[model samples]
Target chain A: MTSLYAFVAGPLAWAAFLFFFGGLCYRLLSMLRQVRQSEPFIFSYMSLRYSLRSILHWLIPFFAMGWRRNPILTGVTFIFHISLIAAPVFIVSHVVLWDEAWNLSWWTLPDAVVDVMTLVVVAACLFFALRRVLRPEVRFVSDASDYLLLVLTAAPFVTGFLAYHQWPAGPWMTIAHMVSGELLLALIPFTRLRHMLSGWLTRAYIGSEFGAVRHARDW
Target chain B: MNERHKEPSEIMDDGVEAALSRLTPEKIQAVINSVLKGETGARFKAYMDTCIHCGLCSEACQFFLSRDRDPHYSPVGKVKQTVWPMVKNKGRVDTDFIRRAVRIAHTECNLCKRCVAFCPFGIDIAYLMTVVRRIIHKLGATPLYLQDTAHSHASTMNQMWVKEDEWIDTLQWQEDEARAEIPSLRIPLDKEGAEIMYSVIAPEPKFQAQLIYQAAAIMHVAGVDWTMPSDIGWDNSDMAMFTGDYEIMGRIKRTHFEAATRLRVKKIVMGECGHAFRSVYDTGNRWLGWAQPPVPIVHAIAFYYDLLKTGKLRIARKYSHPVTLHDPCNVVRGGGLHEKARYVVHQLCDNLIEMHPNREHNYCCGAGGGVINCGPPYKNARVAGNRVKAEQLFDAKSRGAHTLIAPCHNCHSGLHDIVHHHGIDLEIKFFSDIIYECMEKPDGSE
Candidate 1:
C-alpha cells in the first residue's frame, strides 16, 4: 500500500467510527424525543433471542446448500453479499491495515481473487444503480439521497480500481476511494444500514406475531 | 353467440364505472396537496430516498406477478402510478391521473407493509401508499364500499353499524353458545377490575359472530380472567387506519384504550386480527401521541403463545390435516410474532407446509393496511391484482396443504376471497377456531 493512501485511510477510519456512532445517536435521540413508545420492552430478552438467531440466518447459505425461500432473489442477493464480504477480506492492503489496527490475521486470498471479487462488486452495484435510474418503477420515487448513495457506492470501487491500474492513478484517486469508503462506513449506523442488523427482529417479529394471531404454523 | 361489443357510447356505464368520468380536477389537486403535506418528515424522506431498485420487491408484490408481470403493477410501479405523477407535476396532476391514482392507491395495492420488510432499506412503501390513498380519499375518489365503511366509522364508532343493542346481544349470544361448550366459562361484559379486557373489530359482531363464540370458548377453557367492554372502544380495530383519516383513527384508538381503562383492566386482549392489533399498539396509539396503551394491548397471537408456553392451555386433539400459513402484515411484520406462531403451530398441527419466503420475508395476505377496507366494489380488482398470491397459495395447495390458517382478520378475509375467486378448493381457518376446537372442554356448562 502507498504511504499517502495509508495516511488518508487512517484518519478516515477514525472519522468513519466517529461519524457513524455520533450520527446514529443523534438520529435515535431525535426519534426517541419525537415518537417514543413509552412501554417498549426495555427487557425483550425473548425477542433478543429471536433477533440473534436471525442475524446468522444468511450465514447458513455460505456454509450450507440453499436458502429458506424464493431462490431467484435469494440467490442474487447471496452472490452480491458474498462478493461484498470477499472484497474486504482479500484486499492485501485491507488485511495488513486490519492486522495493524486489531493484531488479527487470517490467510489473505491471492491478488487474482481480490481483483475478481472487486470486479464482481462493481458489476453488482452497477446493476442496482442502473435499475434505480432507468426503471420508471424505481425512478418515480427515488430522490437525491437515493442518487447520492449510488454515486457514493461507486466511488470506492472506481477509486480502488483506478489505483489498482496505477497508470492514471494519482494521490487524488486513492484519496477519493479511501475518503468515500470511510464516509459509507460512517453512514451505515445512521442511515438504512441499520436495517441489516435491526431487520431480523422487526421482520421476524412481524411474521411470527401475525402467524400466531392467525393460528398459522410457520412464520 | 357473443354479443359482447356494445358500441362505446351506448354502453350505459353504471356503478363505479360511471362515476369515474365525473371526477373533477379541483377535487383531485386538493386531496393530493393535503396528502403530500401530511405525509412529510423523516419516514417519508427515508422512504423516498432509499431505492436502489434491484427489483427484489417485485417478486414480493402480488400485484406485479398477478398482472402477468406488468411493470405497471409492480410495487415500485404503484409508486410511479400515484406519487410520481404528483411529484413530476409538482402536485399539479390532472383528473384522469387522479382517477388512476385512486385505483392504484385504494384497490391496486394493499398497504400491507410487507415490501418494507423485504427491502434492504426498510423504506416503508406501505406508508407511502397510504399517503396516496389519503389523498384519493379526500377527493371522494375512493370506491363506494370503502367510502361507505369510512362514513360508518365517521358517524358510528364501528365501521359496520352493529348498534349498541346488537353489540351487547351478539356478545350475550356468543357467551351462551360458548357456555354450552364449557359450562363454567363466563363471558363477563363491563366487569371492573379484571386483569384483561377482550376486544374485537366490528366485523366480529356484524358478520363473523362465530369468532366471538370461538374466542369465548377458548377464554373459558384457559380459565383466563378477562372482561369485554360494552362501549365504543369495544371495537378495537379502525378502518381509518386504511382510509388515512387520522382524526377518526385517533378517536377509535382513544375509545378502545379508554374503554379498557374504564374497566380498570391491567391489559387488553384483542381478538385475532393484525391491523387492529397494530392500530392499538403501533399506528393509532402513536397517532394519538400515546407512547403505549394506557393498558398493555395484547393481540390474540401473543395471548395464545403465553397460554401454551405457560402450560395453561393444552390441545388433546392435535389438528392432523396439512396446513399452510399466510403472514398478516401487521402482527407478523409490525409486532414480530413469527417464531411464536411457529411454536404454536408445531404444537397444534400435524403437518405444516412452509410458504416460501415465510416470516418477515413472506408476501402479504393482500387484505392488510386497509386494502380490504377498500370494499366490495373493488373486490374483483383486489383479487385480480393479487394473482401472484393466488398462485403462491396454489403452489402450497399442490404441496398438499388442505387447510390454510391465517391469524389476522384482514388476512383471513383477503385470503378467503383469493382462494374463492381463484376457485382454489381449500378451507381457511383462524387460529382461535382451531385452538377452541382442539382444547379440552370442562365437564359442565357455564
Candidate 2:
C-alpha cells in the first residue's frame, strides 16, 4: 500500500493491464472483423444472438450445474478454479493494495487462511498436472506447451511459498515471488489461458444460445 | 384429405449420382481453395496465432476425455492435423490434406463446442472445424454419405428429398396410425396461425415416421395447437451444418422460418435433434444474419414444458418404466433445457435413472453434429470414441435404467448403437412416445 509497494506493483499491474486491455481488444476486434468479412447471412436471427452471447459469457461458470457423469474431474476442476481465483483477490496484500489505491473495503483474510488457500491452489495445480502427465489419454494428448504452462503456473506458487516462509534469504525470496507473478501476467494473454475470457463468450452464452435457437436437442 | 400417392422413398438419387461421378479432383481442389482464400488467406493465420496450447480445452471436449486423452483426438490437435497444414502452407496443401480434413472435421468431431466451455480463451474450435468442412465441401472431398445428404438439401430443399406430397402423406399416415392408439389424434398440416409450427429432420418421414405418430398423439392429448408445413421447411434438419454449405444451410433456415412466418405461427418448434437445432439456432440462422429468429424458436423440451406448465396435458398414469435421459449436446448444454427435460421425463416415467453427468455437461451420443450421417464405415470408431459414454451408460444401468429417453433423433440413433455395442439391452424412446402413452385424453377413455 505504500509508494514503494505501488512502485513494485507497477510492472505487475501493467502486465495484468496488457491482458485486460491489449488481449481483450485484439480478441474482440478480430471476432468482429470475422463477422464483418463473413457471409452477410451469418448476421441473421440466430447469429446476432450467437455473437452477443459469445461476447457476454466471461466471469461465469454456468456449465458446472451438472455433476453426475464426469464428476471426479468436474468437481476437482471446479474446486481448483474457485481456490485459484479467490487467492489473488482475497489475500491480505491484494486487499490492502485495493484499500490504499481504490478505497475498497472488502474483508481481507488472515495470513494463515491466505497461506492455506495458496497451498490448496498449488496442490490442485499439481494434481491437474499429474493427471495430464500420468493418464495415458491425457499424457498422450498433452504436448510441450502443456508442460510449459503447468511449470510456469507452478513457478509463482513456489516463489509465493518461499517468500511467505522467508527462508534463508528475504529480498531474494520477495523478488522471486514478484518476478513469477509478473511472468504469469505476461504469459496469460499469450497462451491458451487467454480463453479464460473468451470461453465464457462462446461456451456459456453463444454456445447455449445457438443450441437454444436451433432447437438442437440436448437434454 | 387426398388419395394414396406412392411409397415414401427418397425422391432424388439419379441427379445426385450424376453429379457425384462428375466430381473431378480439380473441381474439388478449386472449391476448397476458394474458401481458404476468402479470409485474405488469414483465417488460419489468425487461428495459429491465437492458440495458447494449454490443454485446458481438453476439459471442454468430451471426445478427448472419453477417448482416453488421445492427443490426435484433442480439439487443438484436430485443428492441427486438419487445418493447420493448410494454414502453414498458406493454402498450397494437396488433396490428401483435403481428404483427411474431411474425415476429421465432419466425421470425427461432433461440433458440440463443449471445448469452448472449458477453453481458457473462447476459441470456438467448432467454428474452426466448420471452416475446414467448408474447404472439404469446396474440394468435393466430403465423405460419400454426408455428401449425399448435402445433395439432398441442395435439390429438394429438404435433406431427404421428402417431396411436398410425401411430407403431407407421411403426416396423414402418422395421424392414421396415432388415431388407432387414441382414436382422436391428428397431424394438422399447413394450418395457419397455429401456436406452434413443428418441424423435423427428413429422417422422421423417411425412416422413423413413428415419431410423427407419437407426436400427434401427444399433441392431441395435450390439446395443443400445432401445425407442420406440407412443404420443404417441414424438414428442419440441415445437412448444411455437416457439409459447410453456408448457402444451403442459410436457405434451409430461412425456409423453415419463413414457413412459420407464412403460416403466421407464433413460434417454430424443432424436434429432437442436436446439429439440426444447432444449425437453425446458432450456425445457419447466423449465416443468414439474424440477431434472433424472426419468430420464437422453441426446442421440443421447452414446448413440452409449456404444455405441462399450462396444465393442458396431464398424465393419466406415470410410465412405470425405469428410464435414463441422454443429454443431446444441442438441447441440454447448448440450449439449457436440462431441468425442463427432467421435469417432463420424471413426470412421464415412474422411475428416473440419472446418468452420471446429467444435463449440459453430459457426454454426446456420438451421433450428433451429423457424425452418424458419416455412415457405417466410421460406425465402430464413433462407438470407440464414445467408450466413455458407454461406460457412463453401464454405470447408470447398474442403478437400474431399462429404458432411455433421448429427445433428439441423432441421440436416439447414436445411443442405439452404443447400447447395442455395449450390450446394455436398453430400449430407447422419444419423450413424446411416453407422453402419448401416459397422458389422459379429452374423452377420458384411458
Candidate 3:
C-alpha cells in the first residue's frame, strides 16, 4: 500500500501536472494559430476594456443575466467551483505536503472550513448529476460522458472527505482520491473541462466583438 | 429521460420535403463533412468546447419561455437536436434528420444573439444555428419561400424581384405623391456626388412605397442631401443571409455598397430594417473579408437620433399618444442603437411606456432570421413561438400604450402578425412613420 501511494504521489503526480500544463499550452497555441489563419479580425476587435467587463460581470454571482435567471443553478455553480478550487489549494494537508516537498506553503484554510467546502463540492456534484439525469433540457444535451465527467470531478472530493474523517476505508480512500485527482487533471485539457481556459478566450472574443464592433454589452 | 412526447405540428415545408426527397446518405455525408471540415475553424471549436450544456441558455430563448420552458426550443436544445448530432455522427445522418434540422435552424431560431448575453461562457448558439443553416444551404435544402427570395437576390440583386424600371417607377411615383403635399420635395435618383445615398429594402418599393414617401419628406424637411439609387443595387435587404447563401449575401451587400461608392456618397443611410443593417454592417462585410463596411452605413434609428439630437429636424409637436417601443434585436442588440432609438422616441412622443425588458434585452418579434420569410405554412408556429412577445405587447397596452413603435421592418411585420393574431389592440409604426407624422413639414403635410 505504501509503495502504491508512493507511485501515485511521486511520478504519477508529476506526469499529471506536466500533462495538464503542457496540454493546455498546446491547445491554446493551436487555437490561436487556427484563428489567426481563419479569422484574423478577432485579434483586431479584442478590447481589454470589454473583455475585463464581461469576465468580471460573469464571475459575480447573479450579476449576469443568465446567472440571475437561474438562481439555484447559479448558487450551486458558484459554490461548487469555489470549493473545487479552494479546498485543493488551501487544505492543511495539501499545504503541509507542499511544504515538505518543495518547502513551499501559502496561507492554509482551517481544517473545518475545507471539510465543509469538500462536502459542498460533493453535494453540488450530486445536484449537477441529478440535474443531468432529470431535466429534459440538460438531459437532452448530456451524454454518458457528461455524467462520467461529473463523477470524475466529484470522486476526489468524496474520497478526500472520507479519508480525512478516517472513515471505514480511509487509507484506500486516500489512494483513490490521489488517483482520481491526478486523472482529472490529466483529462481536463482534452475534455469540456478545458472550458476553464477557453471560456476566457471566448468571453474576450465575444466581448470585443460586442463592444468594439457592435457597440453593445455582451453581459 | 422524462422527455415529453407531444404531438409535433405538421409543417408541410415543400422546399424541405422536396430537398429531403432528393438527398441521399452519401450526399448528406459529403456536404456536412465538407462544411464541418472546410468552413469552420477556431470560433466553431471554442464554442463547441466551452458550452457545458448546463441549459442556462434555455431561459434566454423566447421559444423556450413561450412554450412553457420546453427543452427542445432551448438554444442548447436546438444545438443538441441539430449540430451536435452532425458533429458526433461525422455527418452520417439520414434525410429525416436533415428535414428536422432545417426546421430547427430556419424556423425556430431568430439568430438574435440574445442567448450570447445569457450564456456564462457567451457560447454563440446563433453562430451554431448559422452553421446548420450553412450546411442546409450547401445541400440546397433551404425552405422554399426563403430559397425563392435568395433566388431573387441572385437574379435581380434584390429580394423582391423588382425590375430596374419598376424600381425607378416606384421612386417617381412616391416622389410625385410627396410633391402633392411638399411641392419642392423630390426623391433624387442616381444623383452622383450626393452627400448621402439613401437605400431601402425592396419591400418598400413593392408593398410599402409610402414608407419611401415618408422618408423622402423627412429628408426634405430635415434639408439633408440624399439620393436614392434607381439601379440594380437599390434594394438593401438580403434574405440570402438568413437562407445561409453567403455567396448571394456577399453579392447583394457588394452591390449595395458599390452603389453608394459609385455615387461617391459620403455615407449610406438605410431605411428602417434590422437584418439589412446586420447584413451590411456585420455579417455581409465579414463574409466579404472586410473588417468594416466598405462604405459607412447608418441605420434609420441612428439617422433620426442624429437629426433629432443635432436639431436638424425639429418636432413641431410631440405625439400625444401613450406609445411603447419594441427594440429590434439586430439594431438594438446587434447595432447598439438602443439609447439612440429611445432618444428618437422620447423626442417624438409625449408618453413612452417601456416594455419589461426594453432595449438590448428585449424579446425578438419572432420574425427576424428569415422565419417570417418561410411564409404562411409556418405562420402558426412562428406566431405560437413568440407568445412572450405578445404578453409584452399586452403588458404595454395595459399600461396605456396604444401604439407600439418597432423600428425594424421585420419587427414591424412580425409584431403586426402578433397583435392581429393575439387580438392585442396596439398599433405598430416605424420610427420613420412616426417621425414623418410628427416632424415639421415645410408645406404642413399630414
Task: Choose the strongest candidate by TM-score.
Answer: 3
Output the lDDT of residue B47, model 1.
Answer: 50
In model 3, the fraction of reference contacts reproduced equals 0.73
Estimated TM-score per prediction? Answer: 0.73, 0.74, 0.98
* lDDT tens digits, residue span B1-446, model 3: 11122223467778888888898999999999999889999999999988888998988899999988888999999999999889999999999899899989998999999999999888899999999999999998999999999999999999999998899999899999999999999999889999999999999899999999999999999999999887877888999999889989999999999899889999999999999999999999988989999899999999998999999999988888999999999997789999998889889998999998877788999999999998877877888899999999999999999999999899999999999988999989888888887888766666
Model 3 spans > 4 angstroms off = B1-9, B444-446
DockQ of candidate 1 compared with the true complex: 0.12
lDDT by residue for model 1 (B181-296), tens? 66666789999999999999899999899998888878777888889988777888788877777788888888888898899999999888887887888778777766556678
List the candidates ranked by DockQ, beginning with the highest: 3, 2, 1
* Model 2 chain B: worst 10 consecutive residues (lDDT sum): B1-10
Candidate 2, residue B396: the lDDT equals: 80
lDDT of 1 by residue, A4-55 (tens): 6776667767888788777767655654343334323322222444433433
RMSD of 3: 2.6
Q: Which scores higher on DockQ, 1 or 3?
A: 3
